[model samples]
Target: MSLTDDAHLPPGLALAWGAPAKSNRLGRKPTQSVEQIVDAALELADADGFAALSMPKLAQKIGLTANAIYRYVRSRDELLVLIGDAAWGAPPDRVADAPDWRAAAAIWTQAMVDRCDVHPWLCDLPIRGAPMTPNLLGWAEAILKVLTGAGLSPSEGLACALLLDGYARRIASARRDVRDSATTSVQPAAVTRFLEPRLQELGYSILASMMAGNEYSDEIHDADVTFGLDRILDGIDVLITQKRSSV
Candidate 1:
């Protein structure tokens, strides 16, 4: 949806796009810009976690009153949207240089993984719906461009985009969880030893063999990500083929 007026846009989208706030009571001009607020919010979220980044904490980080941020955003969810957009940044330029739609999609998805690596806190934000912020919409455009170029309709491309987005978030989230557990949980070797016996007794011969051979561990590998994305791309390719033939 095209939104030119700040009043029509959500608080977060407005803040992210630098839309002027709706006319309000005259008061002392705030010393901070929206960029400053988002920058400080990003730093705070990185130092702590997204959950710890309350408005009060953000205000303190920027040396403003607890209620000062209210002038910019109406609620915490709005601020979170702003933060998520900033974290996502811009889609990688390599996507445009990719040789094919499949390559473009792969680059786009890998960029997501790289961003998650930089800001592991990104996967923590609640999905409020489709992309609305400027940078995020840019990414949406990038992915959709490739998908449509491959012959899929806009609706089909969007569905495929959601598929890619879901995979990226799930892989990033699981990778983060595994890395966290590996730090505090029993050693992988110890866990493998404990589960191997149970696997054998449960009549799971294949799993038991893999465990005994140490084919599995707590390590989060990009191979699984590549595997999952390949399957998704294969499915999308099938759809593109079907749609192209019909056209």
Candidate 2:
């Protein structure tokens, strides 16, 4: 009874949609619920960093043996995905009718960033494939819908989704690096101490020149998403105009 046999579905769309409710592993209910396990994992990550998350530690936290944890999650990576999806939760609500396409798109991007700020641990999820969870796919669908309505072709809509996701991940990676460094090192100001005097000796003039040669900022702040999304949408607007003209 695989969904694949249905002719109406896009290829692999059923699998990509997410796991079925009928296959929820009902009989295998552990002594501890999935919510308990994920909450324990997230708390551990928030306190001690992602590296501190181990099977034994998580099992101990949730009152289960290390081997027992595998019944619920096949691997550490899968557990990580669950944690990330949990951390992300539901997407923020947006107006049914945004004044314009770019406005609608910016709202979508900002909602993602807000989620990232709330659950910084989400930034650690590996960037390899479509999220195999309903909530995450819903978020992706919303983003793509915004682009498609903005006069982008299907391929262009997909490209926009990838590009926006790349931007979000880049920002998240910078934050993760800073947090990891602080956790592992004795020197609290390692990055700043290293860069401060170098800039002081050279001054803003040479710093500006060096920056021109290498464009990109390592800072993970609200502006990272806002400025980047605005610039990206501006480019998309130009493309939309061209697309309309060509038609």
Task: State which candidate has the highest TM-score.
Answer: 1
Task: For residues 1-247, write the lDDT of model 2, one tens digit per residue.
Answer: 4634534543323332444322334456558655677789889877876677898899888887777876655567666766777777766568235777788777766767667666676676665576556677777777777777878887888787777777766666666676556644454256545655677677855655444444434545666657877898888889889988998
Q: Clash pairs of candidate 2?
A: none
TM-score of each: 0.92, 0.71
* Candidate closest to the true structure, highest lDDT: 1
TM-score of model number 2: 0.71
Please give the distance, in angstroms, between residue 160's alpha carbon in candidate 2 and its true position after superposition: 0.4
Single out the weakest 10-residue window by summed lDDT for candidate 1: 1-10
Tens digit per residue, CA lDDT, model 1, 163-208:
9988898888888887766656467688878888898899998988
lDDT of 2 at 152: 84
- Backbone-clash count (model 1): 0
